[model samples]
Target: MMPSPGAAQPPSRGKARRGRPPAPISPGTGPSHRAWLEPVRSELFTSGLTLDDLVDRSGYSKTRISELLRGNGYYPAWELTFSVTRALGLPTPPLRRLWTAAAREAHKGPDWIRHCIEQVAHETEGPPLAYRAFCETLHQPYLQYARAFLLTDPRARGVVAETFDILWLSWNEAAASPDIRRYAWRLLRSRVMLRAARHQDGSPDLRAAVFSTDEAHAVQDPGHFMALTELIDLFEAITRLPDDQMDVAVLHYLCGFPDHQISHVLGLTPALTRAVDHHARATVETLLNAPNTQE
Candidate 1:
C-alpha cells in the first residue's frame, strides 16, 4: 500500500544510509526543469521518505532514484518519475504536465515524448482531455502576458508554470465553471499580479523607461522628452482602465495578439473584445489629452 501523505514519519529501515542528499540543482538548469524538480524535492523532505522506502514503494533501485531526485545524469523518462511521484502521493496530472514541459526543454523528441507518455497511459484515468488541451493552448500566451507584467523572463516563466499547476489541481472545479477560459485566464492573471510591482494607487507599475531608446538619444532629441512623457501617461492610463478593458488592451496592443486571439485569451467574444479595446483607447486618450493644472 502507498504511504499516507500525512504520515508523521517515514517508516524505519535497518542500518544503512537513507540516501545521499540530492545535489544542489545546477545553476544552468532551465526554469521548466527546476520548477518540477523543486516540488518533487519538497515532497521528499516533508514525507520523510528514505532511499530504502522510496525504492520499496517505487520498485526502482536506490542509485537510480537518487539520480532522479538530484536531477543528475540523463533526463528521466516519465515512467520513473511517475513511479516516484506516485509513491510520494503527488497528484499525477500536474506533475505530468510539469514533466512534459521539462522534457521539451531537455529537447526530448516527439517520438520519445509520446513513448514516455504511453508508458504511463494506464496510470489511473488521469485528467480529462480538455485539461490537457488547455495546458497546451494557453502556455505561450500566458508566458507572454506574464512577462509583460513581471518584466523578468525567469519570474514570468515561474508564474506561468505555477498557474498551470494550479489549474491542473483544480481542473474539475474550473471545467465546471460557466466559462472555463475566463476561469483559467483569471487564475493566471491573479498569479501574475501577485508578483508584479504595483503603483501607489495599486495599479501595475509598468516602466515607461522600457520604451526609451538610449540616454544619448533622449538628450539629443528634444521631441523625445514629449514622447516619453506621453508614453508614461499612456501606461498609467492603461493601469487605471477597468479589468476587462485593461486585459484586452494589453493582450492586443502590448502583446500584439490580434482581436481574435485576445478574445480567446480573455474569454470574450470577438465583438466584445473589440468594444473593450475601443473603450480602453478612448479612456487612455482622455487621460493623455487632459490639460496639466500644475503647469
Candidate 2:
C-alpha cells in the first residue's frame, strides 16, 4: 500500500544480510517521479511546508503531488506545480527543463503501443470485422486523446484496449448510444482513473528502452547533438506553464480543438479559456526569446 505523504512511515526493520550488498537499483521501491523534483521537494521541506501544506495551495490532492514526487503516476500539469513553487517562495528558474525531462522519462507509449499493435494485428487479422470495427470506430482519435490525457501513464494502450473490448462485447449498445465518442471516452477515462488509484511499488521498471539516450543520440553526431539538446530544452520551457494553459496550448495548437470544444471538454469559461491560450502562447514566445538551455 502507498504510504501517506509527509507522514512518518513505520520502519520496516529487518536483519541485515551479512554478505550481500544492496543492488545498485533496488526493484522493491515503489513509484518515484522526475530526477529534479527531489531537490525541489527538499527545498519545500526547508521552507517548512509539509505535504499537507501543499494541498490547499495547489488545489490538488496530496496524493497527486506525492505521485509527482515519487514518479509513479502521470506527469503533472504545470499550473499546479507552478502554484507549489510559488507557495514555497521559489522562482520558476529552470523547472521547465526539469518538467520536460519528467515528460520524457514518463513517456512509455510510442514503444509499448508499437509492440502491442503489431501483436494485436497478427492475432486479430482472421476476425477483421470485430477488430477492425473497434479500430476504425475509435482507435485513431480516441487513442490520440488517451495518449495525450494520460501523459505519464504507462498503461494507456491497455486501458484503451480494455475500453474497446467492452465496446466489442456491447456493440449493439454502443451502436444504439446517441454519442459513441463521448461514451467511449468516458469509459476509457474511468479505466485510466481506476488504474491511477492502485498502488505502484516505486521500484523501477528496467524493461523500457529509452529514446532520449539512444534514438536522440542517433539523431545527431556528438559534435551536433547540441541542436537536439536545445529542442529538448524548448519542451521543458513549454512544460513550465500550468496545466490549464498547457492543455489549451496543446489542444489548440496541436490537437486543433476549437474554442468551443476545448471549453466544453475542459469546462473552462470561454473568456478564461481564451486568456489561458493567450498566456500559454506568450509564455512560449518568452521562452523562445531567452537564451538556449543545456543539460
Candidate 3:
C-alpha cells in the first residue's frame, strides 16, 4: 500500500530481516518541504510582492528566481537570502530552514519530490478563519483612525466608509499584500483629491462641523482648544498647495508612505520625488509662519 503524503511508510519485514535496511532519508525527503515553501510563498504574495519584485530589489536575475521557485536550481545563497529578507522586512528563519532542507533533498529520489508537492498544495490552501483574524488585526487601527478623520467631515462619511470597505475587502483577498496596498494607496489618493475638489470651498466650515455645540461650548482648557484649532489651520494650509506637492506631503504624513514607495506609486524618479517633497515642505513652513506673524 502507498503511504499517504504526510504519513511515513512502514518498512517491509523481508527487507528488515535481510540484514539490510532502506537508505536513510535525506533532510528534504519527507513531508516538511512544502510545509516550509508554502508559507514563505504565501507571505510574499500577501505582501504584494512577487519573485520579480525580489529580483528587482535584490538585483538578481529573473531566471534565478524562477529556478528557485521550481525547486530545480540552487536555492538562494545565504547572502542572497539575507538581502531579500531585509528588503522585504520578512522573517527569515522559516524560509532558511526550508531552503536548507530542500538542498539536502536535491539528489534524493521521487518520494521526496512527491512529498514536497503535497506540502505545497496543503500550504496554498490556507485556513479561512485564520486569514480573517489576521486581516482584522491589521486593519483595526487604520479603521479607528479613518473614523476619527471622517468625523470632521460629514460630507465624507459615506465615502470614507466605502473606502474602508474596499480596503478591508482587498486586504482579505490578499491580506494587504504589497501590490494591493500600492493599488489602494493610489485609489485613496484619488479619493482624497476628489473630495478636496468637491468641498474645497467649504473645508473650513467642515472643521467646525466636527465639534458638537456641547463640546465646543464646554471647552475650558485654552491650550487644548488652541492646539486643536492649530491642527485644523495646518490642514487648511496644506490644502492650499498645488496638487502634486500636496499629494506627496499628504502621502508622507497621512498615509505614511516612504519616499521610495511614493515614487513607485506616483511614477516619479527619486530626484523628482525629493524636489516635490522639498517644495511642499517649504510651502507648509511658510504657511505655518504666516499665522504667527498675524498674531
User: Candidate 2's residue-wise lDDT over 1-295, tens digit each?
Assistant: 2123332221122324221221222232222232345445545544455666666555567777676555444555555555555454443434433444344456645554344223311211122275456566556544544554454435557556655554443344445677554455555555544444221442112112122223445665665657655544544554556656765665565456688876655556789888998898888778777775211
Ranked candidates (TM-score, high to low):
1, 3, 2
**TM-scores for every candidate against the unseen true structure:** 0.57, 0.31, 0.33
Candidate with better lDDT, 2 vs 3: 2
Write one digit per residue (lDDT tens) for candidate 3, span 117-199.
34422222233465345335434323322333444445355344434433433444445445554455454444443334334
Give stretches of model 3 more than 4 Å off.
Answer: 1-187, 193-222, 291-295
RMSD of each: 10.7, 20.0, 19.7
Superposed by TM-score, candidate 1 places the C-alpha of residue 172 at a distance from the truth, in angstroms, of: 0.8
On lDDT, the candidate that comes out on top is 1
Lowest lDDT 10-residue stretch of candidate 3: 1-10
If candidate 1 were superposed on the true structure by all CA atoms, what would the RMSD be?
Answer: 10.7
Model 2 lowest lDDT segment of ten: 202-211
Ranking by lDDT: 1, 2, 3
Model 2 segments beyond 4 Å from truth? 1-142, 149-155, 159-231, 292-295
Each model's C-alpha lDDT?
0.75, 0.49, 0.48
